[model samples]
Target: MHGYTQDKDEYAARLRRIEGQVRGLAKMIDNDQYCIDVLTQISATTKALQSVALGLMDDHLKHCVSEALTEGGDTADEKVREASEAIARLVRS
Candidate 1:
């Protein structure tokens, strides 16, 4: 099973909230809301997404990475590499 399976409901809830925020943003644009206000909402949306990404990374490290390490060998090595790549991508974002 996936590392996120345990908290899948929480993740889905968060994504749903983010989706609502996006729809609100579209409405703001349609209403010709202030530019800075729209930008602020966009920033909030970005931060929410980043929060989810960080949470997923934490879960992966705690569950998937730990399990892989116990197995050792090629699987462990690949998991480490994948985790490193994920961290790099998160950092870049």
Candidate 2:
């Protein structure tokens, strides 16, 4: 089975929850919640977003990377670099 098929719904649900968390965080700020509390929620949302990114990277490596490597040459290297740089950006964000 394709990697996305195994648990796509679960991943989507998690992302939805993360979206809700973000909205809640915004509401908290509007309501003047404690700074520390707002910061904590922001941190949690960041982690959640990271988790989604990591999962996407993992799937891309498993599928796109493998396919590109099989196709061969400089193209594979370029794709690998692209994926690497994307993950790096995700980490930095």
Candidate 3:
């Protein structure tokens, strides 16, 4: 199983909340809300997503990576590389 398996429900709930935030953003645009107001909400939504990403990354390191390292060899190396690439993508976002 993936590292986030234990907290899967929590992640799903958080993603649902973020989904609502996105829907609200679209509604704000449809209703012609203030530019900065929309931007502020956008910033909040972005930060929420980043928070989830960070949590998942932490979980991966604590569980999946830890497990791989215990086994030792190419599997461990690949997991670390995969995690690094994921982190790079998160940072770029």
Candidate 4:
């Protein structure tokens, strides 16, 4: 199974909450809500997504990368590369 399987439900719940926040954002725009208020909500949503990404990265490193390291071969190298790429993407975002 995947490394995130254990926390899959938590991730799904967070995503659902973020989805609702996005919908609310759309409504605020449609209603011509204050610009600053909308911007604040957008920031909150962005931070929530970042939080989820960090949690997933931690789970990946703790479970998948750790397991690959124990094996000590090409798999370990690939996992390290994969994790590095993931971190790079997160940083770019």
Query: How many collisions per candidate?
Result: 0, 0, 0, 0
Error of 2 at 13 (Å): 1.3
lDDT of 3 by residue, 1-93 (tens): 999999999999999999999999999999999999999999999999999999999999999999999999999999999999999999899
Minimum summed lDDT over a 10-residue window in model 3 is located at 84-93
Can you give the TM-score per candidate against the true fold?
A: 0.96, 0.85, 0.98, 0.96
Alpha-carbon deviation at 31 in model 2, angstroms = 1.2
| lDDT at 9, model 4 | 99
Candidate 3 structure, TM-score to reference: 0.98
- Whichever of 2 and 4 has more TM-score, that candidate is 4
Candidate 1 lands at a TM-score of 0.96
State the weakest 10-residue window (summed lDDT) of model 1: 1-10
Instruction: List candidate 3 segments past 4 Å from native.
Output: none
Q: Quantify all predictions' global Cα lDDT against the true fold.
A: 0.98, 0.88, 0.98, 0.98
User: Each prediction's Cα RMSD?
Assistant: 0.7, 2.2, 0.6, 0.7
Clashing pairs in 4: none
